[model samples]
Target: MPQAAKRSNDVPGTAPNLVHPAVVNDDAVRTALAQHMSRISGSRTEITSFGRKSSGFSWITYAFAARSALGGDRKLILRVGPPSGLFAPYSVLPQVHALQALAGSGVPVPALVSSAQDGAEIGFPFFICEHIEGDVPAPWAASELDPNHKRVIARQFIEILASLHRINPDATPFASQAQGADRAELRAITGWRASLARPTARYYPLLDWGGRWLEDHCPLPPCRTVVHGDFRIGNFIEHKGRIVAILDWELTHLGDPHEDLAWAMMPTFNARSRKLYGVLERAEVIELYQRASGIAVSDRSLAFYEAYALYQAAAIQMCAVRAFEVDRFNDMRLAVMASQMPSIVRAFERALEAAA
Candidate 1:
C-alpha cells in the first residue's frame, strides 16, 4: 500500500503539497499532474497524496489519492515510462488496447483511465488507471500463505492464464507479433540477445550457450495466443486468496502460450516451497491449463520454453545492469539485479544438463 505524503504549503497549481522523498522534483510533478487532470476531466482536480509504488526497472508507478468537485475522492495509479528506464522509448498503447479488449473477459485487470503515447502529457509516455486494493505476495514468500488460501490462489492463477490465452489476438495490438510459433520463438530470442549488446559490450558465455540451445530445440507451439510475458506469482494482486487484478502488462505480447507456463515453472520463482510458485507442481500446471484451454501440452515444447525463459530472464537482468551502470538509474533494485546474474547462469546450466 502507498502511504500519503505529509502535507504542507500548496504548489502553484495543486491544491496542497504532495511531496514524497522518493518522487524527484515533487513540485513539478504535482503541478503538471493537477493541470493535466483538470483539463482532461473538465473540472478542477487536486492531487492530495502522491507516493512512489514500485522500484521496478522498466516503468515507474505512483499511487495517489485525489479529489475534485465533479468526482469526490478516488485512488488512482500513474505509470510512466521514463527515458532512463530499462526498456526505453516506451509506448503505453499496447497495454491500453489489451486492457480495453480484456474488459469483462473474466480476467482481472485494472480499469484504464487514460493513456498517451507522446511525452507531452507528463514529459513521458504514461497512463492512469483505477487502483485496485490488494497485496502482492513476493515469490519467495509464497510459503507463508495459508494452506487453504494457497490452494484457492493456485486454482485462480492457472484459470486466469487459460482465460487470457483464449482471447482473440486480432483485437489487440499484439496481433502484429502473432505471426506463428516459429516467428514468436525467434523474435523473443533475437530481441533479448540484441539487448545484451548495451551492458558494457561484454560476452556472456552461459547466455550464448542457452540461446543456441533454445534455437536448436525450438518446438512448434501447441497454440499461439496472447502471452502475458511476465505472468508469475509476484505480478498479481491478491485479497482473501482471490486475485483482484493482474498487474504489469508492459511485456504482454502474442506468442506461444507455453512461454508463460514455462516462466511460471522457473525454479527461481519457487524458492521456498519447491513447488511451482509454491502451490502447484510442473505436471499440475500443464494438466490444469490443458483442461481449461483444451490445448494439449507437449512436454518437449515446455522444456524448450523453460530454457528460453531462463535466457530471457538473464537478458532482462543485463538490461537492469546497464540501467544502473550506464544510465545512472538511482533505483538500488537495479543494482541488486546485477548480483542475481550468477544464480540465473547456474539455473540455465542445470536446465540444459537435465534436458540433455
Candidate 2:
C-alpha cells in the first residue's frame, strides 16, 4: 500500500519533495542517492537536480544531478522497482547483467553505474546509470524528421538491430541465462497464462485463443541471443540527428532475435507514417537485417514470434490491471493501460487469423 503523502514545501511538479504517495519520492530518494554515491566514491555528495520522469510504468524512474568530491558534477538516472511497481518481484540483477553483457556489442545502452536489490538503504531495489542527453520522438506524435534524417536514422536503426542480433550468446555472460529457444517460448506462455489467471483481471477470449495459437505454433529460433524485449521507435534516445542510446530494458531477456524484430514491427508502436518504427519500410528492415547479420530470416518463424509478441503485450497490459486491482499501485497510467486490453486483444486475434 502507498503511504499517505506528507505535506511539504511547494515543489515544482507532481512528484517533487516526496509528495507522491509511493515510497520513492524527492526526500527519500535524494537521501538514499547521496548515501550510495558517497559510499561508492568515498566522498561526501550533494544532490543538485532531482525529479521524476513522466514516462514508464514498471519502475519509479528519477533523473538527477549530483556533486561529489571526487566525481564532481554528474548526471544520472535512478530507477527504483518499488514493491508497488507494475512488475512484482522486481530484480535489478538481470538488467544490470544485460548492460554488462552488451558493453562492447554495438548495441547502444546506458552505462550502469551501480545497482542494489536490497531495499534497506533505499525504499526499493534500484539501479543508477549515466543520463544520456537526447530527445525522444514518440511514435504517436507527429514526427519532425526530414527525409534525409529519417533515412539515415533508419539505416542506423536497422544496423543496430543487426548488431544486437549478431552478438554470440555463448561468448557473453548471458549463455547460462539464455534459455534455449524452446524453453524461452514455454516460459513466456506459462508466465502470461499465470498473469491472466489472476481473478481480478478480466478474461478476454481473443487473448486465450491467441495464446493457444501461439502454443501450437511456437517457433524454434535459428539462434537465440539477447532480446531487448521492447525495441521500438519511442524507446530510444535521439540526439543531434542520431540514435545515441536504447532505453528501457525492464522486459529484456535472452530469447529469439526475431522476438525483438517482430516487436519493433508491432502495430501498437506504429504511427501515421507507420514505417518500421517510423523509419524504414518492413521490406527494407528485413533486407538490411538479413544482409548485415548474414542470417536468413524465416517468414514462417517471424509470424510465430509476431503473434507471441502480441500475446506478450496483452499479458503486460493485464499485469497493469492486476496491479491496480490488488491496490499495489494507484497510478492511473495502469488503469489507462488496462483499458487498452480489448483493442490489443482484437489486434492479436486479427494477426493470428491472418497467420492461420
Candidate 3:
C-alpha cells in the first residue's frame, strides 16, 4: 500500500500551485499522457498538472489545456486516485464505462476521454476526460439563479435521472464488471449499517431505526436502472440555464432509481433554500421525473429512501471525519468535508422527522 500524505486544512477556493508547467516532471507519465491525448485529439499535448490537486473529494484532479493538432484548444480534467487508495470499491474505469454506456441515452455527462487502471503511470489509477465549462453556483445560488432557470435546471436534473434509471446495465459493455442487483434496498441498508459500525462521536439511533424500517418496508420493485450515487446540484454543471454535465460517478451503481431521487431530494444538499430541496420544490422535481420517466413517484417509497439517504450520508461523513482524525487525510477537501457532518446530521434529523 502506498503511504498516505499528511492532511492540510487549506482553505477552500485557494487554487494550489497546479498551473506551473514543471509540476508534471515524471518523464514516463508525461510521455504516456501526451501520447494518450494525441491519440484522442490528434494534438501535441502538454500535461501541466500531474501531481497538483484540483477538485472533488480526496482525489487529485489535474486540469490541462489540450491544443489539438487540427486547431482549437480544449480543457480536460483528469482524476487520479489518491496514493493511499480510495475508500470506495468503484474505480475510475468503471465510471468511464458508465459514462460511455450512457452516451446517446439522452443523459448529459462529461465526455470520457480515456481511462486506465494501471498504477505505474501516475502511482495510482487515473482517468482523463473533457471538462464541462460552467460555474457550479455556490450554495447561495440556490436562491440566486433566475427562478425560471432554477426551474428548468431542476426539471432537467430530475428528467435526466429518469433516463439514467432506464439504462439496462446488462446491455452495457460494463455488464460483466458492474455488479448486477435488484437489491437496491438491501444493499443500501447493509452498506450503511457496515459504515455506521465505524467509530463516531455519537451513534445515531435514527439511522439504525431508518435502516430497519427500510428493510421491513422495501418498496415495490421498479425497473432496474443506473443510480448516480451522489446525485445532487453540486455534482452537476449548469450551463446556459440547463444542466450540461452530470459530474462524479464514483458512487454510481445500478439499483433503485429512487435512491438517486431521494439523495437529490435530501435536505442536506438543499444548500439553505428551504423552498426547494436543492433549489427546486420537492413536488416540482418529483413531478418532472414522473413526467419524463413515466413512472409514478410513490410517497411511501420516497419517504423511505429519503431517510435512507440521510442515514447513509451521515455514516459516510463520520467515516470521512474518522479518516481525518486518524491523520490519513491526504486531500484537504475530504478533511473539511468531514467537518460539515454536524450540519449534515442536523439536516438528516429534520428530513427524518418530516418523513415521519
Candidate 4:
C-alpha cells in the first residue's frame, strides 16, 4: 500500500513542528484510531504511517496506512469536521450515508470503511475510507489547457452530475431529509440569510437586495433530485485526463438539480475565461445536461438558480468572515476569505444587474 508522505518534522525521532489545532495531539489520534479499528475489525490494528493532509475547508483529512490481522494492510483517509470549521456543528452521517448510496451506483466515490458521529472514538466525528489515487486540478490556473482535454473532463463532469440527480431520494438516506423543491430553495435561502443576520457577519448591502430578488423570483422545480451543494470545478479529482472522483459532499442534500448546475457555472470557477467553468459554453452546458439528465431545463429556471447561487456564495463568505473575526479561528484561510468580501459583493452586484 502507498503511504501518505510525511513531512520531515512529522517523522519519528525529529522535533515535530506545530500542527493545526484540528490535528494536534497526533500521537493520541493515532492511538485512538488504532483502538477503534481493532474493535470494529475484531483484530489488533496498527497505524503504521500517519500524515495530516490539507484539503477542504470544512473537513480535516489525514492519510494513513493501517495494518490489521484480519484486514491486512491498507491505505485510507480519515475525515473529521472540526468545531472551528467554516460550517460548524456538522454531522458525518449525511456525508457517509450519501457516499454509501452512491458507491457502485455509477458515481465514483471512496469506499466507506467505517464511520462514527461523535468524538468519543476519534476525538471528533469522523469516517474512514479507502485512499484513492488522483490529482486535484485547481480552478484558478491561467495556463491554457488543451481543448480536447477540457471536453473529455467536461463530459465526465456533466454525466456524473446527471447520474447523481437521477438517484431516487426516497430510496437513499436523504429520504428523511427530502422536501418539495420549492421548500428546499426557501430553506437554503433562509439558512444563508440567518448566517448573514449573525452579529459577527459582515454587512453587504447588495446581499440584501439579492436576497429580496431571490424570494421574489423563486422558480418552481421540475423535480427534486439529490443536489451536490458545492459541485464545482475545484471539487473533483482529475487523473489521466478524466475525473476519477467527485469530492467534498459536505453540502449534499435533497434539492433542485439546477442548483448544483448553477453553482458549477459560477463565474469565479470560470477562471475569467468567459466560459462555464472555463470549459463548456452556456448553451453547450444546458444541452449536455438536459440530454444526459433526461430532464428539460428552462432558461428562466436556470437564471433564477444562477442568481440564487450568487446570493448563497456571498452568504458563505460572510460566514467565513465571522469565523475569522468573531470565532477567532487560527486558520489564515478564513482571514483571506474576509479580504475577498469586496470582490464577492461586486460579483453579486453584477449578477443582480444582469438578472434585472
Better of 3 and 4 by TM-score: 4
Best by lDDT: 4
Least lDDT summed over 10 consecutive residues: which range in candidate 4?
1-10
Worst 10-residue stretch by lDDT in candidate 1? 1-10
Tell me the lDDT of candidate 4: 0.78
lDDT of 4 by residue, 1-356 (tens): 11111223456877655434344356777889999888888999999999788745677889999999888999999887765566767799877987898999867888899998876678788999988888776777724677678778877998899989888878888877665334767877878877888876467777876787787777777988888888888788888987878888877888778899988888787686656657688888888989999989877777778878878878887776676676555567667888888877887787666666
lDDT of 3 by residue, 1-356 (tens): 12344445556888333221112234555566677777666667665544443443455667676665575676778777654443633367657777888876788888887787774445457887788888765555576557777767777778788888767767875556545544655876787778777665556676677666667777765666677888887778877787788887876666677788887876557765544534576777778788888778778778767777877877777766665555354556556766677776676677667666
Q: What lDDT does each candidate get?
A: 0.77, 0.76, 0.68, 0.78
Q: Give the TM-score of candidate 1.
A: 0.87
| Tens digit per residue, CA lDDT, model 1, 118-187 | 8554777888899998898888876676767876887898899999988888877777656543476687
Model 3 stretches astray by more than 4 angstroms: 1-32, 35-45, 48-55, 67-74, 85-90, 174-185, 277-279, 327-356
Task: Evaluate residue 5 in candidate 3 and report its C-alpha lDDT on the 0 to 100 scale.
Answer: 43
- Model 1, C-alpha of 134: deviation from truth (Å): 1.5
TM-score of 3: 0.79
TM-score of each: 0.87, 0.88, 0.79, 0.88
Model 1: per-residue Cα lDDT at residue 241 = 64
How many angstroms is residue 141 displaced in model 2 relative to the true structure, after the best TM-score fit? 1.4
